[model samples]
Target chain A: METLTTPLLIRGRGVVSGRVEGEALVTTQTISGWGGINERDGSIIERRHELVGQSFAGKILVFPGAKGSSGWSAFFHMTRINGVAPAAMLFTRMTTKMALGAVVTRVPAMTDFDADVFTEIRTGDHVVVDADAGTVEVTRR
Target chain B: MHLTDTEKAMRDGAGGEAVAAAMDLLIRYGNALGAERLVETDNVAGAFNASTPSVRKIAENGMAEVFSRLNLDSDKTVEIPQMAARTCQLITGIDDQNWALQGADPQMVQMQRDSEAFVGQRGVNLMATCTPYQVGNVPTFGEHCAWMESSAVIYCNGALGGRTNVEGKESTGAAALTGRIPYWGYHLTENRYGNRHIRVEVPVRSMLDWGLLGYFTGEMVEENIPVLEGQMSGVDLVKLKHFGAAAASSGGVEMYHIPGHTPEARIADEAFGPNRAEDFHVYDAAARKKMYDTLQSAEDRKVDFIMLGCPHNSIEQVGRIAHLLDGKRLHPDVALWVHTPRAIRTVAERSGYVARIEAAGGKVMSDTCPAISRRLPEGVRVIATDSAKQAHYLPAIAKVQGWFGSLEACIEAGLTGTWKGDF
Candidate 1:
């Protein structure tokens, strides 16, 4: 591991309270909760999506918010059942669909960050999400 | 969130472990949504119990565990109790009555049957359809309901004047037990007013036009409630179903209003409320054509399958299909599937429409569609559908070539095994 200076910190509301550390996968585009994702393997399957064919499993998946169907939570629930769910989640804003997804997935989740998380976090950065404290700490790799 | 004494009692395990678990999940879900309290639900629609791999795993642990994991988001297994409100089960993974034609596995069909039996025993009505309103369980005007399917939710909010958010499976299941949903979103009257105004500039007749218009409008004004102003004189339930289904699929639109057509929107002014409409849009022929182009995934239309009646076909739609395929035989290489609610299918059977369609080598399926069934015949490459919702999702979900067109075009493709329409 490289020597790190002061790690960047951001704050948001803790929708689901927990602490997790994982590599971050950030996207500015909203992800569909239904057919947009592959529940069996945790891959973004929505055609032409920026993160198409990328797996968010065991990573800190960050996005603007959820788009598409109310069936979003059901597919996410299948991910949890398959043990392919992300370690944590961060959103710029929260919607009922995403909130219900986070709750059922039981992952450390936060939304409404004070800063633009999309700009602050990169795909391969090691990140720590402390939802109980409403904070995300990023360590650039 | 504030809860009534009875709700509190249920949370405290007074009503048993399952009710308490449900209450706990509801409170957590409400808290996540920043809801202040729970409101009573007069109507509820539960998620269809599918026999997916994950669902099968849940079933292995028994009904209690299934209820806990699927509904309560809990690991502790608990017995299910009677639903507190009028509850109906939405479409299942396979047509319970016609599994062989649907190409469903025997073991999976058995599992789904067992699951449905369990829920039915717990006092939930087994409607087994996406269009629950067609087969009873219609929520009247101003009623509070917890509905799971997106199309049904939009129909409930927009057409029937019933208030509901797009409820998830877990939330709807919990609401079935408690007859309560979190008081937020569409439940509030202030949020129901139209925020955008859309003027239809094209000839808006037929189910196909309505579906195309809805797809175009959803793409233009995503997630915003739109009040439409146009010549909507001949608009009926079939058109509304297609429109609302497409809108909900393409965008996160749970509610919309057509002035003088829908229950809530008597006039443009009434729908828009006191505030000035924030945006104005004109849906013209170009927009409709563009949406049609966007939904078609394949250039070569050597269609192998033709699917109709997504969101479940009404009696009139089935009649139309029966009329189109009256004496024509479907191409041997192509399979045609039509879906409708069971009750409507019964009517079609009585009217001899079902026999006419079956005589043409077509199967009328109930309780499931391609999206929910997630099963198409092996080696099938191209699929044609009249539903924009199915056309939008089938490509991504089923990983097949999707061709979207009118019901007549779909029928023509089924007969000739190739797309004959000019795009």
Candidate 2:
């Protein structure tokens, strides 16, 4: 694993505007919002997903993007009502599902990174997403 | 996102409170997608029912509140106007007559009915089934549409050559009022061509076989279009419907090309256009067998309930299922439900298929399925279904052991109260 002594600043386009900091929950696999997640608790429920049985609540969820049914936005919308929504979202791809989900979930979200975000950020990394400024400050362990 | 003068006028409250709220949501959504502008669409299919417990709190105020809050993602409870587009409702929760069997709360059922009364009056056709293409809302080739429901979206793009992204309630709500959706993703012509090539080394003929290929292809090419190359026999609407549903569930595939079968391409080379894709994938016997095993989420052999007609059955599929159940009875420990569109069910009722299915102890339900309703027959631990889409999702959604097979296999399991693995 690569170690960093100082915080790194990465620039990208902001999707949703807000400033939030949280530990990163990174997964290489894409997430499905409808059939793939239990919205009440914000846990991944898809049987084959890499993050199955794990909850992304209160974390900065870093992944490829959304998949599965068009109920994606609604399920993620329910998470906000239940108070288990992610603090921030950093995705690499943009689909209608992810766009609508990030908008309704009302989280600070960014995409179109300057580098491979997966390699730059890791799970358990301290990260601050300033979507209003279109930047991600990452400090690796 | 760049908004035209008319869109800006709508954003500035030119139409009404509801249209303004709809434009506001669409603009925010389009900016999030990094889209250039909004595309015009006279067709919209969406989910607008208020049956789930989460919406009951919102439904207390009225159906307008539900549409404003959940459908348009608006804080202001505006009076929604008649649909500006030709709109329809997708699969909903709660079957009109089988609410008791689904164990649905009477209040929730009433909310759904009230919501229907509200929107149905506003020009939203209550097609009330997932497969709107089966009823009367088939989009013409190259027609741009805004649609919800993964299975139906895939069918529209892959089979009918209609253009759409996988839309949701909020976006579709906006589209219904403004006749506009984000002009991005599959809506663009350049995004419609296939980039991946999948070679089928084995025969993919029957519905089950087509489903297996679809599941495998989806897993292999997630969210990417694939141009299939092989010789297959006897392809029809039912097979393609099953294929697309399984593909969309297992992955996020919205479109695919089956050479002569799909509308877009007549040959594999044409599927890729001038550049011609070079990424090669092969599906053989081992991959087919593995996919078959993967769909069977059930470990136990005892089956208690059998479900058929996911993506809602066509008239021919219902007829074949009726033939399979003729002169037979379901096991004492088993229950069966067959879901189809209400319009088709009306036809089935006239054709005697409903009575034949009911004679075998299966209920012919319309308007919903267990996955969408998140309700099942009481105390079902294991279920068998002919739909690979249902088999893939029901295990996770309902916590039941799922068995995937052909219609004949599902019927046999329902009759015996146990999965024989005969197919």
Candidate 3:
């Protein structure tokens, strides 16, 4: 486990209201919903993805938004059922696919962030997402 | 967000536990999408159940519970009620009829059947196809609908001129129960206008050419409405379907327009709104050829599987295949599968096209395709397809070498068990 100092605060609209704390996993590439993910494990399986083998389970996933197919929500729904879903999700932009994924996953999700989430958040940073207040507290560790 | 009195009543549990739960999910989904209000759609077009590994693991929970958790986004299990609008099941994981041919286990087949029966009993028209529009679920122009399946969404929005967003399984299910969707996205008049202009400089005649153009355009423009200009005369439903399906699969295009062909796009100016389009593109012969080359994975490999009817084959396409394979038998090693909607298959059966294909050692399947079902026969190394959507997706989903060509080329490959085309 990593410890933290004074945390940096960022705000956004809380799409799915809840609170969760986990390590941050940030990516600029939008994930494909159809065959982009491995459902058995929560790993990104798209051939050219940056985080090809990294698991999204129990992390605070940060991305621009979803891409590819409307099948995005169903794959994420599988992640939740397998107990391998992200603790929370943060998107710089929101699309119908990503929004529906957040809703169905029933996780603490926030989108339309005020800051550049890709730059401000790092892979190992401990982050707390308060979807109700539309804020995220990131503790660089 | 504003809800109508009826919507309010349903949200407040007036319609029953199921309707209330459905409303709650829709409200949240609408809010997340920044929808101001809910709009009543005349008919619910399609609803697909999630067929992921997790859903299969909990098969014993029954379809209602699976529907509640996966579709309704509710933790508490709820019984599914009769859909408020006409609803059809989209593609499932297993082929309902030809499970053994696809090498599915008996247990998996039984589970799929059980779920199908459960949903069927609840008044869902169990068409079990990706191309529901082919089988009497066609929404008229400007009709607001909630539809799943990427290819169908593009066809509904681009070719048929029906309004729909690229709806997810959950949202489609919710929309089926409530007969409504968030009044936003493609449902709005302003969002349908084209933002990008694609000038076609190449002669695109065949379905394969249209598919290549679509693949090139989709790769170039992601999530932007493209208005195509140039030679689009005599573009039929089959061409439009292949074009839109390829675009939707390669990119996230829910809708596209050909200036003269698409309903909303009579003139290029109207399609681009008041201002000139932001992005201008010219697709020439070189680009078309380049895209065709890119889709073909291997030229010399022996194709073990040849699949057609990606967006679900039209009856005309099925007839063409039967004509091509009239007296020729497929290679013993090659498994040739032709897919179409069940209704269209019924017509094919009556016309003896199904029998002809079967006599040629090929199977005319329905309700599923290899791309969605991900159930290719074991030990299959190379797969050939006429559909750009299938070629693009099968490589990633099924981990096979994909060769893409025209329907004629696919038929030839099926006959010889090898790909000799140089496209």
Candidate 4:
């Protein structure tokens, strides 16, 4: 395999700015089909999270897919209602839950990323994401 | 995704506005997930936030406002054993401020209120608790169902051997009204069997313990459906419900199986279907206990809040509490909330159970539980519950000591206003 430096090339506006770039919270872990994400606090509260306290407020959040209950969408809806939401999101593939969350949050989001993106990115690596062109710009910093 | 003529027709506005809207949403959901086909569901179980009086009021108030604005009749649903809206009315006279603390969002709360009101006035079946399975939304083995609770999805898939996906709330609502969902993910036959195996050497006793085990399994497994060969006979519906809730809470599992209990898994090999069980984990008793311990804190102290019923309470469960607390009063220092369905509460009221519990200073509420709204009492540092599900989820919302115990212990805590970990 060719050694790829900048692994993901994702493009999206900086909803919140800190010049902070991390790899990506690449999760095979699907977001909850129900109240998995706390919209008010913008934290993942699915309990089994390794990134329990980690906030999606500013991160290149990526997931294999969205799963679980219908209330899943409402969680993000609640987050926006509380004014705490993700900066950007990347769906390795999309689910209705993620779509609803995207609609509710109106954040920069892209999906249909290559399946190999899962193997390429790791949580807390440097990458840039663009939602408009559906491309994630990546280079491991 | 390929839509059949019927599905196409429904999408073309033949199945009525509700069906058309549902079809549109299902189509979009399918496209998003790369689903190639749409599936039909006979039943769906819905769960949303119903934790506090304020949130409940918001839901009711919002619904009332929406119904007035839309000029839509809320009474349009066919009554089933599970369908009852009175549960939403339980918070009628309670303090509103307590609800504000439970993370009630005005907009969504209003939306929920409106939707719930519309649903109610239209005679829609009000199944508001997260775990609808407990409320008689049982899909026969292999019957397609859409459920909003993550754990319910897993349990329905694994234990009940019903077909479903951990479909989102809106998707489920869409499917519920229209009776269709994109037959994409876990509902597919290819997705039914287990890819991972959990070999249990543990003594999984009660529903709470099973719930703890589910949390453990959820953490251990990824998105793969798990086939668990353990103390299967010990599993019951309530325990399975708690397990499903906890599993969904801990990880992403749409379905799971306990060998004998779940329809699919008559035995371990059956759960794998045609696949050879290669990937597996051995879970011992100690491991199970450790999982239980992970969700609980050892600190014993006064709990300002004690909420029972995570998947909403069954009539029997509430009746038991009412009987237990007959003539007793809840400590004024403690705010005790019991979540259940309105119909069940009505039964409780008729049976004089609600009054007994109410007279004892506890409340029997419906539509909301402590988990969703995050509506807990203020100035409360420690919290306790008999529900492993509530015990697990509440700490995620606030900094508090989480304690787990039996229902008797929980009610006792409610009475004395103490959350001492020792049951």
> Which structure among the candidates has the greatest lDDT?
2
- The superposed Cα distance between candidate 2 and the true structure at residue A47, in angstroms, equals 1.6
Q: What lDDT does candidate 2 reach at residue B404?
A: 94
Q: Looking at candidate 3, what is the lDDT of residue A3?
A: 67
Q: How do the residues B1-423 of candidate 3 rate in per-residue lDDT, one tens digit apiece?
A: 899999999999888888899899899999988899988886565555534455676667788888887777788888788888778888777777788888877877787778778778877888888888878787899999888788888889998889998888788888888888998899988988898889999888888889988898788777889999886555988888898888876778888888778888788888878656788888998888888887877655788999898888999999999999999999999989999988899999999999999999999988888877888877888989999988887887887889999989988989998897645
Q: Mark the regions of model 2 whose C-alpha exceeds 4 Å error after superposition.
A: A1-4
Q: Can you give the TM-score per candidate against the true fold? A: 0.97, 0.98, 0.95, 0.77
Worst 10 residues of 4 chain B by lDDT: B84-93
Candidate 4 TM-score to native = 0.77
- In angstroms, give how far residue B159 of model 1 lies from its true place: 0.8
Model 2, residue A14: distance off in Å is: 0.6
* Docking quality band of candidate 3, CAPRI definitions: medium
In order, how many clashes per candidate?
Answer: 0, 0, 0, 58
TM-score of 2: 0.98
Ranking the candidates on TM-score from highest down gives: 2, 1, 3, 4
Query: Which pairs clash inside model 2?
Result: none
Q: What are the C-alpha RMSDs, in order, of all predicted structures? A: 1.6, 1.5, 2.1, 6.8
Residues A31-114, candidate 2: write the lDDT tens digits: 988788999999999998888999999999999999888999999999998999999999998999999999999999999999
Candidate 1 lDDT by residue in tens digits, B345-376: 99999999999999999989998888888887
Query: Between candidates 3 and 4, which one is better according to DockQ?
Result: 3
lDDT of 2 at B223: 90
Model 4 Cα lDDT, one tens digit per residue, B324-369: 8887888888877777766567787898888887788877777666
Quote the lDDT for B358 in model 4. 77
Per-residue lDDT of candidate 1, residues A1-141 (tens digit): 654678899998999899999899989887887779999999998885899899988999999777677778888888888999999989875667888888999999998789889889999898999999999999888
Docking quality tier of model 4: acceptable
Q: lDDT score of model 2? A: 0.92
